[model samples]
Target: MTTTRICVDPVTRIEGHLRIDCDIRDGQVVDAWSSGQMWRGIETILTGRDPRDAWLYTQRICGVCTTVHAIASVRAVEDALALEIPLNAQLIRNLIVAAHGIHDHLVHFYHLSALDWVDVVSALKADPMATERLAQGLSDWPNNNARYFAEVQSRVGKFVASGQLGIFAHGYWGHAAMRLPPEANLMAVAHYLEAMDYQRKSNQITAILGGKTPHIQNLAVGGVANAINPDEQSALNMERLAYLKTLMDELQGFVRRVYLPDVIVIAALYADWLPYGAGVMNYLSVPDFPRDTKGTDFGMPGGYIPAADLTQFHAVKHFGDPYFEQNVKESIKHSWYKGDWTRSPYDGETVPEYTDFQQDAAYSWVKSPSFADEPAQVGPLANVLAGVASGHAGTIGYLNTALERIGAITGSPVPMAALHSSLGRHLARCVRTQVLYDMMVENYQALVANIAAGDTTSFNPPTFPKGEQMGYGFHEAPRGVLSHWVVIENGKIKNYQAVVPSTWNAGPRNQNDARGPYEASLIGNPILEEERPLEVLRTVHSFDPCLACAIHLHDNARQTIVRVNAF
Candidate 1:
């Protein structure tokens, strides 16, 4: 059998380090594996510490999504302590989660994942005038190149002239998947640069509120530590709100004016991609923005989209609520841990053994988190699906529109299967961004009214007076369903285990011989070359992986004695 090796020395524009390996045949990847060689033990480090301090330690797991981790940890601690935050606390927590959603989505689409699909080299030939027309046709916005797209043209020309297409190094330059005209590519390229600056400003909302980006300090179990009075609340009033509002506008603009159109453009070019790279039919999501009283009471605000073989969607319900208790569990059969191999998260246990590369000893510190004893796809797809199933206001309508768009592109109704690829993942993220923007607006209005009625305290620190209890805190983080399980004894952490978004998506095969989401998604992808494996990148980017947060290095030694003797 003839084989072509497809490889990517270093996947660019991702948060952490990983190299893609694929075994290819006939220009398609039939098999693939993602390798990460870095390791640090935050989980082990935090062992035996006070349960109250777990949030502080977890927040440092990753700099990019620290706030999300902190929120999960605090909520988990709160659950364990059986602490009910003040109403104001709920509102603040909601805002922090919302802010993280917006920031993470923007960063994913523009900075971390865009290059995989967008071609920087293509922009060099774009005719600026035509781009302006396309933008005008797409929407009526005041782009710096609104009336004229030439300003971008000049700079892009220089970058290309300099013979340094830094961002396009691994881009499938002439791949069949590229479809946007040079002009449209030009528009996207310019906005790609502009988005970097705009997204940074969007981050300030988190910075001012949380204390910093990547990880914030304002959130706690009881509620936010940062107090917001009338003046502090003013930050979300007109000016700050308007700035946030601008981001929404820009985000929508990019989706419509650039991202969607580019997707269609590429889809048209790679019609064959319509059938390949679909992973397991199982889909699971933990929704956000619950409107109903029942939905609110239980933190489970989303639905679980099962694999194709599974039946209808099921509500994940809140962590504190007893409703979603049926679906969550962790399996250790294939994992390194030797403790109870299979256990319900409600009684989950985490006892880390030292790092050993032996497949059984402990290949990765990440534990396998299964919903219904199976791996489930998380992230944008899960968010959208869960939101719709949870009776989230307007979710169905939004979904219908997305489905229609996918249908039109593929000439077949977009199946749940389509939601597993690079294009599907990117498109799903854009749709979710719109959903999050609206949710933030709704919460912002609610916060204003709550403050008007005379409630100001957003937190209520607890004493853990009883000094022993267990709490399960769950939320849909940027990556997917994130949960914290805590066991408190004498007010200190007796045991802890986290079912993070990445662990669900990135974990290895389970005891029953099942592939994780990433592995399954890589199946059927055509491997192109050993030197540049595009399929591995496809699956990796599809998850918008934040391995840095889930939390992976190298060693070279010198031999001096023999060398000195030879010399």
Candidate 2:
């Protein structure tokens, strides 16, 4: 058997720099490597800074998922001080998280990864009437009209005729692996354009509550910086609450009538992808959306599910869960770091020691994070599985609906085991989005009711003690389980480390030399064309790799930071 090496440097349509290398044998990937091509040193920058101001700095780690870091940072500091957040503050934070997550998931599916599955060039051959009929049969979305699809087709045709495809320029158009019919392609392309407007509406919910979207200004050490005054003009008044409800209504409508159904249709069309990309199946997620001050109660349940078995789920119940903290360790053995020790994030170190891509040695800047002495996958799949295992009604309900819809489309009952594949990840994300929308509405109503009861508190002051304190905060972020570990010595940050979601998925090899999630997921993935490995991207993009969260650094000197070695 002849083996060929394929390298995709700086994988497009993602957040940061990532390089993927695969060895193809007999038209299938036999071995793979995932490398984070940059170094993120936010932890080092947080050292010696005021612990109260950590959220402001940590939130700047990634431009896309800024709100997640901010929420996690505040929770970590509050946990360290043993502070209890006000109910209003908790509800407000929950709203921000839920909105941001919905927005992020929408953008990821329609804008980022959808192109890997939908072919734009083929849409030009579609008949407007056929496309409209296809979309209408799937969902009763108002835009499923022949004239509207024809208008979209004309706009896309103009892009093609102008000799500039803009965003659609570099796609693997007309590839043999592209299997959607021309009518289905046209429908998907139309939705791709309309998704931009709906996603913005979802993001507006975050901006309204958090003061801004990219880096929210509402987070503080003990509680949110938002003031609660029902009648006052400048504070959280009824008018603003009503506006939030309106945004939630529009977002929920689009998600249910368009986003969820679109994903199910695409999953049914690409059902062949359902058996691939089930890598590093030990799943880990953390409970979020706290209902009380101490963080013991949650709106969504989370835990560890080993080997995709929901029966073995172990729940992470609170803010500072020992099961989560003690078992989490990052190994730098195959990373471009100083040491080869597998230490907890509480004692983690980040010293750069670059060695150009050695296949069996140091390769990526992403440190392998192991949950309970083994590599575990994180993200919506993990979150949904854990929720189902814990008997969360909302998660189970949405998940079953999605499975049933796919089954109706494909003419076969989609089994639970199918969720361990690439299509499963996509379906799980949509299910999670539906659950999040319900949570958002519930939190909004709770906020309104609490305000009507004459309780208008939204902040709590904090005071650090005279001795050392250690605390860790975990949130089931948009990507997966995001944790911030802090070591405060007399009100100053002594050591800070963030075990981000991307680090858990895109990591190279673990301390035991086992391949990480991204690498392991590509093991049996079929590579139809060695030159244009579109199949390779479908599996990787399913994970929604965000290298900026795993590793990121900018050079002020503008010199070449590192050299790429082609295989």
Candidate 3:
């Protein structure tokens, strides 16, 4: 049995740099390692800075997850200062989160992960009429006509004819893992382009609510900075709210009729994937989209599921629950850090001790974040499952709807347990998106109604204490549960650490050599072609690994000095 080492360095289409190393034997991955190849010392920079301004700096951690970090940062400061945000601010922030979630989910599926399963080259062979029929059967998407598909096919044909695959390059197009039919591929490709427009619309909604994109400027320590006035044009007024409503409606339609159906179609076609990529069964999710100012009532539920057992699940009722706060610890045992001790995030340190990559030693820049000394998968699947366990009506409804559609497509039952795999991650994202769309409308209406009731306040300026105070902010970000831990001393930041989603999913082995989610998921995956390694990409991409958010940046202007030796 010859064991071969396969390295897919700099996995394309993801936000930042990541490398996957797998030991393949008998055409199956026997062992694997997930490496985040850059160092992001955002926490270090936040030290000694005003806690209020930490959000502005931490938000720059990643271009994709900027809004999430900003929100989390402010919440952390607010938590430390015991600041209570206004009703209007809570609602406004919820809207921004929902909009960002929709945009990020769509981008992940259509732009980043779809090509892993979709055969773009085969799409050129798809019959436009058949593709149109397929599209209509799936959803009432308006662009399902033969002419539209034909146009998409023609564009793809020219792209293929030019021999410049452009974005489609470096993909294993004709591999055995490309299970989707030509018509399915064509439909996915078409929706992929449609998603770009919808993505922009989601961003537009965020801009309206947050006053800008990428790094939103409206968020303050206690709440948001948006001035609510019904008749004023410069404020979050009637006209802006009306325009925002239109964008939400359009995005909701696309999610319901297009994105959800596409995920189901792909899942049904690749049903074999249901058995693989079921990484660590333990999951974590945080409650988000607070419906009330006190945050006692939430639009989405949060909890911890140990070993995928709904029976043993524990729900996190509010922000900074002891169940969450006390259990979360970051281990630098197998990371590029100076210490081997597992410390809580409140006391977490990010002292970098760079060593050359070692297979059995430090291999990644991401510190191993564990819940109760155990590695848990965190993301859409976790959030959805946690919601299901906690009897969240929206989660149950959307999940049932998704499972029913998948069952109908596959002509069999796709159980709730099926959500533990790669296909399930995609389906769970669609389910979560559906739930968020409903909540988006609900929050928007609440915000509008609040302003009409003559309460236009959106912020509560925080007053810091004299001594040191520690607090962490939690957000159910697009990736998963993101927490920013900060210790404030004399109104300035003393210590800062971010236990991001990617760190939970993509970090290296902990003190016990326990694999992270990405490594565990790749253990039994079938490597159809070692060189192409499409199966590996599918599993990794399912996690939506954002190394840019996990590890920091490197100088791309300088040439990498490492030499490659081919065997």
Candidate 4:
């Protein structure tokens, strides 16, 4: 058998720099490697900084998930102090998280990964009226009209006729793998534009409560800085709350009617993908959206599943659970770091020793993160599986709805087990979005009700003691389980580390040579074309790879570049 090496450098349509190398044999990927081309050293920058200011700095780690890092950092400090935030603070943070997730997931599916399945060139050939009818059949979204689709089709036609593909430049436009019909492609193209408006509305929810998007300003050590006064005009007043509710309403409508239907339709069209991209079956996710101030009860459940065996599942009862904390370690065996030993994240070190890519040696900047001595995948799919396995009502309801819809479209009963593939990751995101839409509304109502009952407190001041103290914060973010570990000594951050979602999924092999989720998923994937590795991109994008968050950026002093594009 002749083996060929296919290298995809700077994988497009993702956050940071990544290069995927796969060895193809007999037209299928026999082996693969996921490399983070840049090294992220944000953790090293946090040494000797004020613990309270860590969130502001750490959030800069990724422009895409700024709010998530901010929330996680503050929560870690609060955990170290053993502080309990006020209920209003809890509600406010929950709303920000839910809203950010809505925006992130929406942009991820439509803007980042949709083109992998949607054919823009084909869409130009679709009849505008037929596309409108297709959209109407999928959902009752009011944008389902002949005029709206015609406008979208015309825009697409102009883009193609201009001979400038722009973002669509490197796409496998006419690949044999492209399966969707021209009419379906047109419908997706229309929703893709409308998604931009919906995502903006979702971001407004974050901005209203957090004072800004990307990086929020309201988070403090103990709680949020958002003032809660029902009548006060300058603070978080009733008027602002009403406006927030309106934004939430619009966002929810888009997710339910537009986003959910699109995912189901796409999944149905590519039902053959159900068996591929089933990477490391082991899953991990932490509970999010605390219902109380102490973070005791959660709106979402978290747990671990080793080897895809749901029967041997273990629930993560609370923050800093022994099973999670003690078992979490980062191995530098295949990373461009000094050490080869796997140590707990609290004691983790990031000493860079860069050497050009070596297939058998260090290849990535991301340290392999393992839970319970095993590589586990963390993301929406993990969260959904954990919730469904643990019988969490919200997760169960959402999963059922997604399975039923996908099944109805494919003319077959989509079992729960089918949710272990590339399509499953996409479906899980839509399911998680549905659960978050309701959670956003529920948390918002709780905030209003609490304020009406003469309780307007939002922040609780946190105090740090002398000597060394260490703690961790966990959140089931839009991508999956995101945790920040902190070591505070005498009111300063002694050390800091963030085990981000991308790190878990895109990291390299461990000490035992066990492949990471991205590498493992590509093992048996059919490479339809060597030059156009659309199948590889589909699997990688399914993880929504954000190497910027997983590994820090590379700053080059001599290079000056400017990008300008017309959409």
Clashes of each: 31, 1, 2, 1
Residue-wise C-alpha lDDT for candidate 1, range 160-182, written one tens digit per residue: 68787665444677655556577
lDDT of 3 by residue, 1-567 (tens): 999999999888898899999999999999999999998888887889999899999889999999999989988887777677798999999999999999999999999999988999999889999999999998888898889999989998888899998777777878987888899999999999999999999999998887789899998888888888888879878998999988987888798999989998899889889998998999999999987766667889988999999999899888767788999998888889897889998888877888978988998999888998999999999999988888889889888987888899889998888988988998998899888898899999998888889999888778887999988889999899999999999988899999999999998898678999999999999998888899999999999989999998434345685668999
Q: Which candidate is the best by TM-score?
A: 2
Q: What is the lDDT of residue 481 in candidate 3?
A: 91
| TM per candidate | 0.86, 0.98, 0.97, 0.97
Off by over 4 Å in 1: 3-10, 144-148, 166-172, 175-177, 231-272, 290-300, 309-311, 323-326, 332-340, 344-365, 391-393, 405-417, 552-567
Q: What's the lDDT for residue 304 in model 2?
A: 96
Tell how far residue 280 is off in model 1, in angstroms: 2.5
Which portions of model 3 show Cα errors greater than 4 Å? 554-567
Q: Each candidate: what lDDT?
A: 0.64, 0.92, 0.89, 0.90
Tell how far residue 202 is off in model 3, in angstroms. 0.6
Each model's Cα RMSD:
5.2, 2.6, 3.2, 2.2
Q: Which scores greater on lDDT, model 2 or model 3?
A: 2
